[model samples]
Target: MEATQILDVARDGILTMVIIAAPVLLAGLTVGLIISLFQTLTQIQEMTLVFVPKIIIVYMAVLILLPFMIQQLVELTERLMDLAISLP
Candidate 1:
């Protein structure tokens, strides 16, 4: 592959990864922030309190987003394969 083509593929892969991960990451961040706020207000600083809800919410977000993530990955793979087949 040409340098530009390689770079394009890499960029696309990274972008796809970030797009796929964003929902779960954002959900985790939101849950953590809310828990932190609650802890601050209540003067409760249990570490598990912060971790458990974030993990559950992020897992739920991942489950909800799994289909879309799979579609994006399949599309990216198909495009890369097509590019490879067309390459000299």
Candidate 2:
């Protein structure tokens, strides 16, 4: 493959990875931020308080988003296979 084709494939792969990861990451981030705010307001500084809620929320988000994530990954794999098959 040409350099541009290679770069394009790499870029797409990275973007797909980001897209797949974004929901879970964002859910964790948002849960953590909210938990931090609650802790600040309540003056509670328990380390497990932050971790458990974030983990649960992220896991729930992953479960809810699993189908979409799988679809995106499958599409990406198909596109990659097509490119590989067409490559010189």
Candidate 3:
């Protein structure tokens, strides 16, 4: 592949990765922040307090987003295959 085509593919790959990961990451961040705020307000400074909820929420978020993530990955894979087939 030409340098420009390679760069384009790399950029697209990175963008797709970010798009796929954003929701779960955001869910974790939001849950963590809210838990932190609650801890601060209630003065409950248990170290393990944050883990369970974050895990559960992140898991739920991943489950909910799984279908969309799979679709995106499939589309990306198909596009990559098409590009490979079209190459010299």
Ranking by lDDT: 3, 1, 2
Which candidate's TM-score is highest? 3
In the range 1-88, model 2's lDDT, one tens digit per residue, is 8999889889999999999998899889999999899999999988889888887898899999999999999999999999999987
- Clash-forming residue pairs, model 3: none
Residue-wise lDDT of candidate 3 within 2-63, one digit each (tens)? 99999988988998999999999999999999999999999999999999999999999999
Which portions of model 3 show Cα errors greater than 4 Å? Answer: none
Whole-structure CA lDDT of model 2:
0.92
RMSD each, Å = 0.7, 0.9, 0.6
Compute each candidate's TM-score over C-alphas: 0.96, 0.94, 0.97
Q: Please give the clash total of every predicted structure, in order.
A: 0, 0, 0
In TM-score terms, candidate 1 sits at 0.96
RMSD of 2: 0.9
